[model samples]
Target: MNKEILRLPLYTLIAGFILGIINLITIRILIRGTNEWTLEMGKTVFYIELILSIIAFVFIGILLRQKYNRTDFFKSATLLVIYSAVVFILEQIMQYWGFYSMINSYLYLPVSIFTVITSLVARISNLEHIKWLHVIPSIFAPYLFLLFSKNPSENTAK
Candidate 1:
């Protein structure tokens, strides 16, 4: 059996864990001015998922570049999109498993958007050609982040 398949999840999990810590620090910074830490804490799971997807996009790009020894923007972008979807689905499964607070229903779109931005950055920094269509996903990322940071489900009945 090829042992390489076993390393994939390990890579994904390490990527996820690092991004989770970054997400926690981000949450801390965002909530520093507010009085409701407990409320905000419940949203950490969503942020962790979002941040993990973003980082995973870049990580995947790096891996592809190293493997091919060239920048293939379209290929990397497509893979990033697919990978983001998989991660989002897995997060939903974990939430259903009661591993974290319920994922905010509105979470998926924003994370997908941010994943595009991060992937683009990774490509551009490595001198990949700019594809205008690829820019679409990042256009609303800032606003989406603001929306996502608010914990939309916190006050509602699921």
Candidate 2:
């Protein structure tokens, strides 16, 4: 397997983890006057996270467009799954540290599901066919979850 094939997903995982930490810190600093982290604050941070993830996906897609090659489906799927799992684990750690008390699911489940789909599609499709359309599901996932979920407050972190 070409090491290059692994670069985009790995870079995305590392970047997302770092950016998530930075986002939590920045939000905490900005909301220092508040006695407790509110749902609104959590939503703000999550929205920012969603945007960051989208940006990362687009950047990676563009960066690798010319260079991306079709690899073994299982290998590509495994790498993407690992990327999703690591991201979810890191976010859980952040939540455990009290950074995501007001958030539920932290966009992990939906994002992971959509990410794997988007990545697999991109990986298997012709380079020319990999476009912004591939990311629409991911982009809508958070909003869709929020719209369809039962009381968001009930699902807040313990």
Candidate 3:
């Protein structure tokens, strides 16, 4: 990884929000054919997912850049795992406290993908291109969950 990737937290955050909006646009386009989405819920999920995604993007970008091809890859990976675990725990805690909630299944998929991709970027040191085989979970899991949610059984029938 380049030394500069480690230096600019501000750029990362701004660029991350840019990616958040890109994610929002992608999600909007994705949910376009679904009758299941209400405007308010779409807005809410966009903001939530965007914020969470950007957070993961920035942290993972920074951490990966710093650790890529260094001797500390395992240590970096372990930290990523711990970070994801904490996010998962905090999300559950928030639900328990009624701070906010999603269906339990909604909670895990994104976080798991986040960790997997974080590990990928850590090892590969490339952003413009990803190794799809390694990062496919991030590429597909959220949309798959969205698709599965549209299944009739999710809403009504078996």
What does candidate 3's lDDT look like per residue over 1-158, in tens digits? 54432323333334445554665686777678786767676556545554666466556545544324332333333343444465556755876798765544343442442534444453467455444354444433222222112333433432
Q: Model 2: what TM-score?
A: 0.48
Give the best candidate by lDDT.
Answer: 2
At residue 105, candidate 1 shows an lDDT of: 27
The lDDT for every candidate, in the order shown, is 0.48, 0.53, 0.46
Over the stretch 1-158, how does candidate 2's per-residue lDDT look in tens digits?
Answer: 66765655555556556666777687978699878878788657656655766665566555554444333223443566554556556656876798865343444432442554555456567565656566544444322222222343443432
In model 1, what is the error at residue 70, expressed in angstroms?
16
After TM-score superposition, what is the CA distance of residue 86 in candidate 1 from its true location, in Å? 13
List the candidates' TM-scores in order.
0.35, 0.48, 0.35
Global CA lDDT of candidate 3, please? 0.46
- What TM-score would candidate 3 get against the native? 0.35
Error of 3 at 56 (Å): 12
List of clashing residue pairs for candidate 2 = none
- State residue 55's C-alpha deviation in candidate 1, in Å: 3.7
